[model samples]
Target: MTQRNSSFPLTRRAALAVLTSALAFGAAPRVALSSSPLDVVATTGMIADAAMRIGGTRANVRALMGPGVDPHSYRQTRSDIVAMTRADLVLWHGLYLEAQMEQFLADLGRKREVVAVADALPEDLLLSHADYAGRHDPHVWMVPTLWAQVLEGIPDLLAAQRPEAAEDFAANWAAHKTELAELDSYGSDVLSRVPEGQRVLLTAHDAFGYFGRAYGFEVIGIQGISTESEAGLNRIGELVDLLVERGIRAVFVESSVSDRNIRALVEGAGARGHEVGIGGELFSDAMGVPGTYEGTYLGMIDHNVTVIAGALGADVDPRGRLGKLATGS
Candidate 1:
């Protein structure tokens, strides 16, 4: 695990009591709902999408990290601080996904309402890292069913302040949960079409372990779970060997992480007489542009499943199961 640069409390347990107390007594500071929207600052687009869906008309959410932003190494800008401090609520993906910003978020929680959504998930259900003894993988959103577990935290946190809109938040979350269940089923059905031997998902970073586990694919990453980790030459050589040996046809690039390492694998495989193609760019750490279909959490996974299935020789509808995917994907 990468070290936090700042000296401050790092986990959600430190602030859990405070939030729970607020929820129990209804004494938490409310996001002023009289004249303006409840200003919300989320660390990533996925969290931002959840806030939007859960907050509905009661809040205005802003993401500190945008499309193609790598949360593992993302540093807070002066503008980020301004937005966070001024916001009525702050939501971040905990479990160390935002490696560089954990301390800052923890410190911020001391003074304001800050909730680590993914931290609310049950420990027994989380996947532990191979390298880190007790730490869990932060990319829980890769699996829609597990991602739905994270949704339970958002509405509670939002309701701590805005009690009036709690019903709306709960209802929206339930609907979204049903959609995610369907998405998870869709992923399993589509990904299963690839021959069991061909169900290999190679990417720039280890962000899709949950996805692979959920859909029965063997995932390989050039780098570790965190994009901050280095992808060494030996690792690249080993992957190239695997590609050649397995005759893997496609490897993926992440929108947030650089494709330089992926391209190297393709070239190295070629040198070893294996012809591998760049499968497609995947929305890993971040989603697509703000207004597009791929920007939503559902669309993000839909695009990933569609692309992976198509590249791996699965017979999936080009226009996603929901018929909302962009034309070329």
Candidate 2:
């Protein structure tokens, strides 16, 4: 695990080929005596989606934190702890996301295959969760390339839990890698349309740093990376001045966090002779509701891209890239 830049995969076609070959040879889902998919648990919806995209019919992935559930403040219930203790393999975002459950994870590791996907990301590249402390950003799934690495780890985790399913896990992962690459390209293409001067991405919090670096935008968040950081009145006032001075007309809100911060900014900007509307809600810490198109990982990213592109005046439709978003993305 040397330091690696979170860039798009170099051999796109080759990766896609791997996915195709592996998936074609994958074994059909087997019925354990319990009659269920593998007992897979992820810390957040985004991570769960990555695992699901790779595991497919071979494994069942569950996110402890569902749509709009804030991971930063999430406290594990007794059942959640019990679930982790018995899981075939437990996956979490790492960094301080599941802070409330950190000890449980540490203890669970002694008896199970528990992995922190965000831990796989290179350190130097990660934005400081704190100045003198944490080495990485827990929001690792925001960058498609880094997320791909997280997904790649799934094969090994699954194989460790169920040795008999190693081949199936690897094959499913290989096949899914290509689709992830395509999704990255789509995000890049849409964001590239916005002019350099107007590339500022103002949001609810500092969740989009990786996304900004990947797609060439300057991200500004009213709140810090950890929502625990206070969004002081002065901080809001200063941001308002900058937004009005920059003539920024649209700012995005997050689906999981309260929009009160952004609402204050809009009202503040108005008082200073500027009018900024809610661009659209972006999925920062979670995905949309279950059973919906946006519920899937790809759909979640697709929804963000669709909304951002349309808001920024990029020439793409709000429906989404390739017209696949019509399915509710």
The global Cα lDDT (0 to 1) of model 1 is 0.88
User: Model 2, stretches more than 4 Å misplaced?
Assistant: 1-36, 129-133, 326-329
Q: Rate the local accuracy (lDDT) of all candidates.
A: 0.88, 0.80
Candidate 2: tens digits of C-alpha lDDT, residues 4-36 = 333345466677787777667762233243335
Who wins the lDDT comparison? 1
Of candidate 1, the 10-residue stretch with the lowest lDDT total is 1-10
- The digit string of per-residue lDDT tens for model 1 on 1-329 reads 24553423555566777878877887655523352457899999999998898888878999988889999999999999999998899999999899899999999999888888987898888887786556788899998889988877888877777777889889988888889999999998999899878899999999988988788889988998888779899999999999999989999999999999999999999998889998898999999998999999999999999899988998888788789998663
Q: Clashing pairs in model 2?
A: 19-174, 19-175
**How many clashes show up in model 1?**
0
Candidate 1 colliding pairs? none
